[model samples]
Target chain A: MTGRLGFWLAHLFVLAYCGVLLAGFVVQFGADELPCPLCILQRQAMILVMCGPLYIIGRARRGDVTLADYTMGYGMSIVAAVVGAGVAARQILLHIVPPDPGYGSAVLGLHLYTWSFITFCVVLVFCGVSLIFGRELVPRGVRFGWASKVVCGLFLVIVAANLVAVFFELGFHWFLPPDPTRYETFHGLPLLGAAAMSGGAVG
Target chain B: MAILIFAVLLLAGWLTVRGSRRATVLVVWTVALCAVLAVFNHHMAAKLSLNF
Candidate 1:
């Protein structure tokens, strides 16, 4: 529960966040579901939440870990999670009525937005507890181990993938449709045109 | 655009990991603000089922 341990734990949380984001992608492709605008906003909020941990990890690597680092990191995460939770809650409410199946397929008996709400709640709890227990100042000379490096690399890759995915999703447009059906960017590409066309048909 | 927003967020994250605290903070805040605006815009444009 020491600040030092908390700092290391932050890396694991970062990895967990990455896993969640990856799961969303898996559902997107595996289930052939295109994320709606609100869904994309939730994803963006998740990414912003992860950045807080990344900030703390970066500071720890420099051997200058401090209380301010932890505060800023957890504070930013808390704020993002709150916003994400709100978005997810809104989505959940939109489908709460009877005979209304939620957006996309259910994962483990819960829709993705429902799961997102749970995740954001967990984040809030995690940050709150971490802030309370992780008060000790970590010693100097801390550096990134191999696992941390791999996690950070994975995070960067996820961010880059999102960039590409979103660009294609909103291609040539400033906003995504309420119910996105295809990658706009791929509408004209020979290889992906048919896929995009098929997706458009679904809409 | 959503692409530009994510791009900026990615840059901010990268900068944070690279130890550019001030720049990262500024960029993250900017992205957060933009995201809020985009969310509002989406709500305004979309026809929601919610009564409230």
Candidate 2:
């Protein structure tokens, strides 16, 4: 495939993956399943992975995909995926030996954390192998297209929402609960939306 | 920590779209953010004592 095609494919894949992740978040929040600190960490890893493609989309705005661009993007993604896999694996080990009940609902017999581990490992291998053939996907000077704009815009919105979620849960004071069952707010008020109303409020 | 990372991400996004001749800057900023998140993940896992 041409570098252009590869760029489009890679960007689309990242956006689709993030869309699914956003859906997962909706499911979790809709179910009132508050994310733990570890879960938050995993989400951050996902964001990092997303940024690899995001950077490309952004860079592609000015030019075509280059070998250096692919290398850096894939490298960043692979490293992040590896770290994410490690985190997920840690979560898995925590529940496996002790056979703890586990967090969130099970999906197809495996918990979400287990699925995250598998997903991260798969992403890691994919990025690593893709990097080996980076030369094949050469950067050609290209302009920002509508599709690229949409993908970047979507990613931005998701990241912003993630920020809001984290803020609502932990607040500016960094008061993270060991086990969060629900979002902490003043009288169920939205802390993220109205900041001045609750000045000096922490958690 | 989450707040800080997102702030950086928002800045990177801005740079990616707005900064003149900032392709290199954007790439470096993103890679740096990824590294920081990875290290933070390790720290959080260790702090929580997730084991392995």
Candidate 3:
């Protein structure tokens, strides 16, 4: 892919991911208790993910990626990937061992702890794959190290397999339960006449 | 499963970023879900209090 296309995809993913994360956080804080430690770490990975696109765009906006800026940006992503992977591993252990009861009914809604784990893994993959772009390939003497090709490749393989497993599950009709709704707020009473609600839905 | 929600893109922002014309449709959907939950939240809390 062209650099610009890659840039746009990176931007789009990170931006939307951040949006959903913030919305979920709002939903959580509005109702329940404080976020767990793993949740906070997941948010850190999110910040790291968002930072990559921001740094690139900000530098482009300013007309160039200064050597220092490029190095720092690359460094941040590398650190984030490692940290994110660690967080993911921690959450996965919790998932397997059951350290904390999921904060909410797993059948009724998404569990925040589970989400923290998944988001951590997503960020780890995003950051790790992003480093493969080699945007900050250092000069001979400056070369610190290359990202682990083997580990990154294995991660991609596992994620791809998991996605296929999801497709299989979908084929089998396994699905989360949703609550039945009683009030049809939009189509209900005289106060909710279609005329008044037409604009409401349109909005 | 929640996996379906991921595959289907729970938030429309993903669809919009993927080039959907009316991605903001998701914002309204989310707001509606939140409003319903909020209303239920109050009702459920009240009902539980009376039972107690």
Name the top DockQ candidate: 1
lDDT of 2 by residue, B1-52 (tens): 6667666766665555442344655565556456555655555655664343
Residues A150-195, candidate 1, lDDT per residue (tens digit)?
8778988998998898887888887778888888887747777787
lDDT of 2 by residue, A75-191 (tens): 767877887787787777667865578877887898878878888887877776677666766545556788777877777778788788878876654545657765565436665
Return the lDDT, model 3, position B25. Answer: 33
Q: Which residue runs of candidate 2 sit more than 4 Å off their true CA positions?
A: A187-203, B17-52
Candidate 3 retains true contacts at a fraction of: 0.06
lDDT of each: 0.80, 0.69, 0.42
Candidates by lDDT, descending order: 1, 2, 3
Report candidate 1's fraction of native contacts. Answer: 0.48
For all the predictions, what are the DockQ values? 0.59, 0.38, 0.06
Cα lDDT over the full model 1: 0.80
True contacts kept of each: 0.48, 0.24, 0.06
Better of 1 and 3 by lDDT: 1
Tens-place lDDT digits, model 1, residues B2-50: 6777887788787777767655575665676567656755774576644
How do these models rank on TM-score, best leading?
A: 1, 2, 3
